[model samples]
Target: MAAAFHVRSNSFPSRPHPQAVHVDEQLIRLRSSESASTTSSSCIGQRLCDLQDLYDSLEKLLRLPVTEQTIDKKAVDKLLDGSLRVLDFCNITKDALSQTKECLNEIQSILRRKRGDLSSEVKKYLASRRSLKKSFQKVLKSLKATDGDESLPVFGEAEALTISAFRSLFSFMSESTTPSGKWSLVSKLRNHKRVSCEAQTANEFSELDSAFQSFAENKSENPLKMEDVKRLESCVQDLGEGIESLFKSLMKYRVSLLNTFGH
Candidate 1:
């Protein structure tokens, strides 16, 4: 009877540990997923910092003085070199991003399934990258080289001249609005397109207008200082903001004149 009982017990098939096998597989997947997430997150974080640095460099380059008086070729070249280096770094980052996209996406998917924090960092990286791209485009358009010239084309020169001219014209118009006497510089300008003024107030307008015209004619003079350029740029930007469509037409006309006369 004892031998028979022992034989029956041995005959029972050994049950497979299915639950233990599943738990082990789950643990392995979780660990591999976390490892990949850490690596991708680190790469993205480093790239974001690099992009921010590039943005700063671009801002610095854009803010440099470009007035007729201070547009130094050598100095501009140095800035351009720095900017190009940043641009190159951006290219490298893009390449790295492309290469790691599959791994990043995999990690992203895993994190999303697990409701992880690293997913948010990935989203932030994408947003910052877009912002950096937009900033680079704007600065590039503003500083585009013309006619294959190494230096930025003198696009601002015409704008500066027009701004100065408008400043004078507006001053003279104000005097005309509240005339101390019967005639003023504005009256002369209105009656006969061009006229010389002798009044102290009129002379001030006259001098400003004359200086602007001279600067337009002789761009090599470089009489404009950094402050002068900044003021003119600000004035032009303000007017454009105020009357966008009209400003565009006026700017087109001014640009045409500058192009024809080589200001």
Candidate 2:
């Protein structure tokens, strides 16, 4: 009868007791479900953040295409719901969580290495492209001066030229085909009858009309008066503010990705 109560006096815990293991597994399942919901919520927030970051990274990855950001919807989805290797990742059963972590870590390690290589490859590509561009900077400046409106040997087509140089220098730009390949850019120059295009044409000469007035106000070698520069600066400032807001979102997502995955 005393044996029925269990006679082993060794306080040493045996390998996961069958009943304990069972209970642990159940707990793990429940926790996983709850965490999943939180993770989903976090993802929604993260996507918004990523969208903003995409905006900021634009100037950097301008060659990719504007719609498809560097972090991207896929990466952001992985950050939130994908089988991520998390640190202190699970609070399920000690045994089950430990095993899950082992599996997750192994998987993440492989991906981590691959991702690093891909990033380096992309970065190197950009650097090489930039070097080539610098060799032609003088030629490009000349073209801009004359408003050549034509492509060059190095830059390819006129529109294409803007994107390649803009990507190398400013970046914060592109998607499939490249930034300038966006439907918007293509469409901008598509119809000769577009209202905006017509408006722009009319305004092109407006600057000249203001030139004499500007010269009278303040003489300068550049026909564009101080007011024009001021207006341009103001427009740039607005763009900067939008970029800033987007940058904050990206930073937030980065923090979440790092923390959640135990980066």
Clashes of each: 0, 14
In the range 1-263, model 1's lDDT, one tens digit per residue, is 12211211233235413432332343333233323322211122222222233233323323322221233344444334433433443343344334334334443454446545533444443444344445444434433332123322222221222222222222321221222322221321112122222231222212323334444456357342333323323322322232232233333433433343244
lDDT tens readout by residue for model 2, 1-263: 12111211133145533433433343333233323322111122222232343323322322222212223344335433311211111111122223323433333343455433422332333343344335336434543464443332111121222232222212111111121111111111111121221111112112322443344345345332334323322322333333344345434544554453345
Candidate 1, residue 61: how far the Cα is off, in Å: 8.1
The CA lDDT at 261 in model 1 is: 29
The regions of model 2 sitting more than 4 angstroms off are: 1-50, 53-224
Candidate 1 displacement at residue 170 in angstroms: 54
